[model samples]
Target: MRRKSIQNWRRSNSPVLKRFCASIGKSLGLPNQVADYWDTMLGGKSSSTDYFENYLLSEIDSPIVIGLDHVEVIFQYPEIASNFFCLLRTWNEKAKYGNSLSQVWEKLRLVVVYLTEVYMPLMIHHSSFNVGLSIGLPEFSRNQVQDLVQRYGFNWDSDQIKQLMSLVGGHPYLLQTALYHIWQQDFLLEELLAKYTINVRIYSEYLSEQLSNLRQYPELYAAFTQVTNSPTPVELEWEQALQLQTMGLVHVRGDRVLPSCNLYRQYFNVSASHLQEFHPKSGRAEG
Candidate 1:
């Protein structure tokens, strides 16, 4: 597709996207034709985030609640998550008031649509799900996922909790994304996190990208080192957080990951070559 795949799409916020999507959609009263053409180009979302959005975008919007379990689903397809993260940024920048991304999430239809279409199919077949699943989080036994969520203090009624735990585990990435999804989907935020788990391989590519960034932008690395080496606090940037989360470099901890993990801790953590092998998309690593 000329419209680059998920990865390229998330790489940056083209200043023109808002204007582009809006101009096309508004000019035609609804870019039905463009959207239809997109359907053909992208294969019409047979089973993915776009599928969910197809239905969700037309529904309610506001005061939605999300649990960590929900975030796991969104993470399953990180490419699509750019929209959610971007929407969050947009809301943060202009909310018609002073609310933050969290407040806007519950009312966000675009993200909800994304979760319903792309991730649910994966969830339906998995035994256990977590953040690592996108990293891909292996589906676990039913009992395991339930237990993971319970541990996080989110009370998913045993009845539909499975829906929540479908994508990932207790891993911070999955945990945070799950939470974000639930809010976007209009559910109650019973628990902040419903599960946890670990999948290191997916993170390796993530590490590579980080190192790539460091190498590409030495100044950025220098900025990071100042924060890493100093006791003084560092200001957080939503733009960077959006990039890292999209690249799978860190988990979502209340909107920011702040670099915490074994991968993050060791030798300044530049071993993407080692980690890439285990990734679902990337082949196995060498000995």
Candidate 2:
């Protein structure tokens, strides 16, 4: 996970500030004054709420939309993440509840994108984050996949498309990668499927890292191995199952866990006998 500090967001916004300052300087003929005070006015430590109101909203003539992606990075640092979220909640509340700062705070619209749900770690009340629009991205439907393939100029029959889906289970990333290779390298669907059954170079690093992470927690690794080797779905601890699901390597069906796709099954289906050999030395040391 990227351990970016909160200052990173402020740093990114610096360029926007500079541009705005330049325009203000040109209009008012005070470039020297603006340059001298810009650092003092914007750089000092303050509540995120104050920063949003005084700087972001005050400078812009129209509504300001702020988007933060991969917020999951903060999950590793729970206290910071919780405090940051609370600060956002405070900003949102000030807008909705009509505080003295609400006039400016209302101009700020925050769009946060994270891999997992924030409630899993957020310290504030659930209503804080729930008040805003929440959109859940769903996997692509069969028609969507077919349309994507057609756009790539692959005139595959239904059976071929089904074969590809069976291997990738309609996963957007895997399907896109497969289609990219087919379109760019002229690889046949059969050739791609065969490579996937053995070892897919495109997914090698990701697969390795996932496996390495699994080794860090023996229970998760054991659950993964059990599910991969089982012909039928197997039950795992709810948290373990969730961890696997979060990794996009397993799917939870009612009370059982199953490999997310045939590709995962083929690649991660390590038998108990192979566990010792496959375990990472770093994981062993930590253990």
Candidate 3:
């Protein structure tokens, strides 16, 4: 499902688990009376684990795929997150048991998408993330970017593409945004790159969102600061490096880390003073 649809629930005053169940019930096409009945009956005494297993088995008769995007927001609620994820593992395992109920569970497929690793601890046996066919999308290569440029009907030469890649690396979203704006004649390629770091017109919202996330975790903010400020790759704590790499903010080479792209380095560097406010003491403080 779209992240925006559920993101507001995360910030709501009501209990997250209730909102979560309500959303699921709605997706299952249960009427409000039935859903509310279940909520009133089970909300106080049981967890989502019980609700999903019992309800999904009886409710669904066809193959159902639930795609959850931006699942990282749930990490902030560890108890609910852990319980829900473990429930997913249980559902998957139940489908493999070769019992009558297996047929029901086998019809249920899950697609959980998140930007970063689960920093929080989860029992391996109970973790659904470990069992899935994980797919990690790598950044586009230079050739891929060039292909995209041509696909966008741009007749730019190799050097022009190179200059654009140098600024945004091969980030798909950034490349698309730049290409779209230039294609619309909003700015020339040279003008776009020249004013990229200074102007907030292109990547202001994206950069601001990343900055806000980093501010939430001071150690991550500090670790990213070091990576951006350095001329060469810098060493970071294993967890810190992993988290930053997963967040698409930095690239890890061996034991060293560097900014993922010139865009990140330039944008974050300009905001370095603001970042320093998050961790005034050390740039390498552990999160």
Candidate 4:
């Protein structure tokens, strides 16, 4: 089971073909048959990505959705990232163009989710992803937030609800976290907001991780810094806007970019302050 996990399969430096084959074989109740073929295939120099493509083409008979969450993790490993994305792009193209393997390939639909546009770094061909459906999930609306509040059995008044929305901007994760903490721990609503100024520990770790990611990408961090300092939406490079959107850190409207919600604005204000303190000369007022 340990060897069968996808993370282990991708990260392991050891040969994955045999382990992958063994794992899937057991799941499909064809361990011996898969092992026999893997033994033979391992002797060749065929690319693992190509081999996986062929395996999918041969194995899939019905509709299947291959969901990949937090795909940004792969971006850290560029060689594997590029090949895997290109492989997915090719599979999609094959499905669209009708090839020898299109019959099975067409049955496979890839759903890649990430906090940043992984394709930016890979420079994937536009035709690959452009033809497929791209759905951007929206933030929770007022009614949705109300529904959640009611379900949580919180007797929050309209004013309280409005305040919460004003602070978090109906962001699903933040709203849920705020509500959960309020309901479970019996924390005062006013106190929570006041505490946010001093601590922001509720979202500290998540914000820290996001800030850490931004630190690795200096240009992206600079764009975010501009967004944070501004009282209104600011224009940014298309790639920068997309990066912020994917990270759930900002809302993009036409050419303007704004911090997704007040939660981000408050936390990132501190981040921006710290960045300026350490590298004051590097700070800019605008993007």
Q: Which structure among the candidates has the greatest lDDT?
A: 3
Write candidate 4's Cα lDDT for 179-257 as tens digits: 8888877577787777775337777776777777777788888898789789989999998788688777789999999
> What is each predicted model's overall lDDT from 0 to 1?
0.39, 0.65, 0.73, 0.68
* Stretches of model 3 off by over 4 angstroms after superposition: 1-23, 31-55, 96-100, 117-128, 197-199, 274-287
Tens digit of per-residue lDDT, candidate 2, span 1-287: 13344345345655433433344345433332334444554442233334445554566666666677776666555545565666666666666676776777777677877764221333333634576777867667789999999999989889988888888877787788889888887577888777653345776766676676666567777788889889999999887787777667788999999988887787776434455465655233233
For every candidate structure, what is the RMSD over all alpha carbons to the true structure, in angstroms? 16.6, 6.4, 4.7, 5.2
Query: Model 3, 67-183: lDDT tens per residue?
Result: 888776666666656766776666666665636656666776778777653333334223657766688778899889989999989888999988998888888888999998988
Local error of candidate 2 at residue 32 (angstroms): 15
Model 1: per-residue Cα lDDT at residue 239 = 55
Number of clashing residue pairs, candidate 2: 0
Which segments of candidate 1 are over 4 A away from where they belong?
1-109, 112-202, 229-259, 267-287
Badly placed stretches (over 4 Å) of model 2 are 1-46, 54-60, 116-131, 196-198, 212-218, 270-275, 278-287
lDDT of 1 at 96: 30
Candidate 1 structure quality by residue, lDDT tens digits, 147-224: 766665667776556544433433455445555555465344443223222223334454444565554444444444
Candidate 1 displacement at residue 189 in angstroms: 32
**Among all windows of ten consecutive residues in candidate 2, which has the lowest summed lDDT?**
116-125
C-alpha TM-score for every candidate: 0.27, 0.70, 0.79, 0.76
- For candidate 3, the per-residue lDDT at 172 reads 88
Question: Which 10 successive residues of model 3 have the least lDDT summed?
Answer: 117-126
lDDT of 4: 0.68
Displacement of residue 178 (Cα, Å) in model 1 is 18
